[model samples]
Each structure stands twice: as C-alpha cells, then as structure tokens.
Target chain A: MSEELNVSCARPIGSEVDQGIDDSFVIEGAEASKAKKEETTMIMVGRKAPDFSAPGYHDGKFVNVKLSDFQGKWVVLCFYPGDFTFV
Target chain B: MSVDSMFVHKMWDEEELSKMVDGGIPFPMLSDAGGRVGTLYGVYDNEAGVETRGRFIIDPDGVIQGYEVLTPPVGRNVAESLRQLQAFQLIRAKKGAEATPSGWKPGKATLRPGPDLVGKVWEVWKVDQAFED
Candidate 1:
C-alpha cells in the first residue's frame, strides 16, 4: 500500500442528491434532510452486485460457488479473518 | 490477499466448518482468498490485509441489501440477524411498502403511511412507514 493513500480520506462514490426545500406538506425538504444524513455514511443500495467466484468447502469437497449461481436464492456472503475459532 | 485472488480460496477447511454447522451455526463461511473479499468489502485491514469479521446479507438478486462490520472483541448475533433476515424476506415477499421496526418478528404488525396508521400499526402488517420520529 502506498503511504500517500494512507494519509488521506477517500471520497464517497455515487450520485449527488438535491436538498432544496420548497414546502412543508410537499415533504420533499424533510426527505432531503434525511437523505443528506444518510448520504454521509450510507452504503450503496439497489445496485448490481460485484461479480465474484470462489471455491467453497462443503460436504467434504471444494465446490465452486459464484455470485451468478445464486440467481434465485438469497446468499449471505460473509468474510472473516480466518475462521472464527473463538466464537 | 491480492485483489486478483479475492474470494478464490476457502479461509477454513471442511472439517472445522462441518463442526460449526453441526453445532447449529447457520450461514455459509465464504472464503476471501487470503482476504480479498474483505478488502473489496472494506472490512479488510489494509495494513494486515485480512478480513475484519464482517457480515453481509445479499438479496436473491445479488444485491447487498444490508451489512454489518465489526472489529475484534465484538461479535455478531446470529439469532437477531436471522430475525432481521426473516423480516426482510417477509416484507419483500408481501411486496408491502414498509420497513420493519425494532424487534420486528414475522407474522406481526407492520407499518404504513397515514395519519391514523401509527395508532393501528400493531394491527397492520408493515413497519417501514410506522417508524416513530
């Protein structure tokens, strides 16, 4: 890793949201306020998944698991340091 | 781990994982290739370059709907997370326009938008719109 990369903050990626306020009952202003707060630390939602493929050890074998294979099921892809031996 | 190798290798062996599964450990432990998945997910320690115990709940469509990242000494609650998953799945299944409230359980009340909705949220079936300010 570069030392220069370590000393700075990375800008958030994605589209900018408008926070302009026009009225009360219209409720667009309140929505902008909430969006602004969320924009600070919010992870991107409703986007295409990052493509990935891996060998998963299951049932005494290393089976190939890809993001595309799970087209119809909810896949909880979790990554940990090694294996959680203490937990 | 190198970026070219992320999610390519199983972090643990089958025997250890089998034991965890037999002990009622739910969810699959994806290998991050040395720790490549962790790095891309931002849960990886750049200095050490290993996963930092992060969990992500991806929807059926392959989108990461929700996630939680934790540092060492802090663990994730599987049961609670499962509940959240159930709520998410249920809400999605129903196609109701609402989000689950705190401690939301399946088959319970959900929230909707309206003036009198809050009063009867416990009786309705959506929780997203019933969130209290």
Candidate 2:
C-alpha cells in the first residue's frame, strides 16, 4: 500500500481581484509627458527570495502559508497564469 | 503557485487538472490575487496583466539556487527541475567536495573540484568508464 502525504493548503481571506491593476501614472501638463515603459528585472540566483505570506489552496481547503515556513526544505515556486487559459 | 484564487484552483483541480498528474498536485497553490509575488519575481506583465512562466528552485536554507523565467509562449520542463534538485541535494550531501558533470545522474562518477583536475579531467573521467559504478 502506498502512503499518502497530507499537504496543507491555505486560503486567502478576501475577495479576488477581477482585473489587473495598472501601475502607470500620467502627467497632466503638455511638457510633462513621458514614454510608457514596461520595466522588468530578473531575480538573481544565489540570493534570498522575497518573503511572502499568503493564502494557498490545497487538499480541498484553504490555509495560511508563508515562504519562511519551508525553511529547511527545498522549495520549487512556480508562477503561472490562471487555469484553463492559454500560456 | 498561480495568480488565481483558491476557489478557482479548486475548480480547476476538480474540473481538469487533477487528471493530468499521477497523484495530483502535491504542492500548495498560492493565490497571488494582487500579483504581488509576481511583480517581485519580475515575471509580471503589467500590460498583459498576468505572470509569465517562472520557475524557482530554492535550497533548504531558503537561498534561490536556480531560476528560469520564460516568455508566455514556452512551457517549463519538469524533468530538468527534478534533475537540478537532485544535483543540488547531491552536492549538499557531499559537502561541496564533488561536482556533477554534464548529463550526470545518480551512481555516476562525480568530478572532484581542484587545481589538479583543471586541465586533465579527461584522464580521470573517461566517458565509457565513468558510469560503470
């Protein structure tokens, strides 16, 4: 018989956002215009990951989870878009 | 983890995702509702409003050992991730004395890092004789 591992899932405590928030700001004056730019920087390897504490879904339930909780274990953090959507 | 909420994750798991894997997703799916984590990882496309494909391999001590962020058109390889994880674990077990060569696997001969093995690795590491053990 195979033993099953019970993983805990945390749930967020608020409603989900329906749309993505625009982080850009516009200047009102004619000479104050600036080009719209999308700046992105890659997180370097061999550095500490940013700390995060959020709700996670697992095993038919929601639970509070944090990055620090996995201190002594290897963690593979993958971020993808929503389900049932094209990548 | 995904940007979708827990409810959405549950729905996806029940509807279609669970059948794709052997034992289902063993890891927790974090809900980054506001894209906070995605922005930190630098994979969030503000205009597209979604995180690009990103994979991070963190060690036991919480240091990021490896990471890859790809465009939306590409998918990641799970086999590579497993191989990297196993390689890291092996190096950790060996206390950093041994290093893995290209295409190295368990039971294969590992190279010992030193000045002596710098220019003459071929003498000690024959391709046909390395994996016999």
- Please tell me which predicted candidate would have the highest TM-score against the true structure: 2
What DockQ do you compute for every candidate structure? 0.20, 0.38
When summed lDDT is taken over every stretch of 10 residues in candidate 2 chain B, the lowest stretch is B124-133
Residues B15-70 of candidate 1 have per-residue lDDT tens digits of 35545556433333344555444544567677765667677777888777778777
Q: What residue runs in model 1 are displaced by over 4 Å at the alpha carbon?
A: A1-43, B1-20, B23-29, B114-133
lDDT of each: 0.54, 0.72
A16-57: candidate 2 lDDT, tens digit per residue: 222222447644554332321122233678877766666766
Q: For every candidate, what share of the true interface contacts is present?
A: 0.44, 0.73
Docking class of 1: incorrect
Worst 10 residues of 1 chain B by lDDT: B1-10
TM-score of each: 0.62, 0.76
> Could you give candidate 1's per-residue lDDT for residues A1-87 as a string of tens digits?
001112124321112223343444443678876754543334455654555554443443334455666777886666555553454
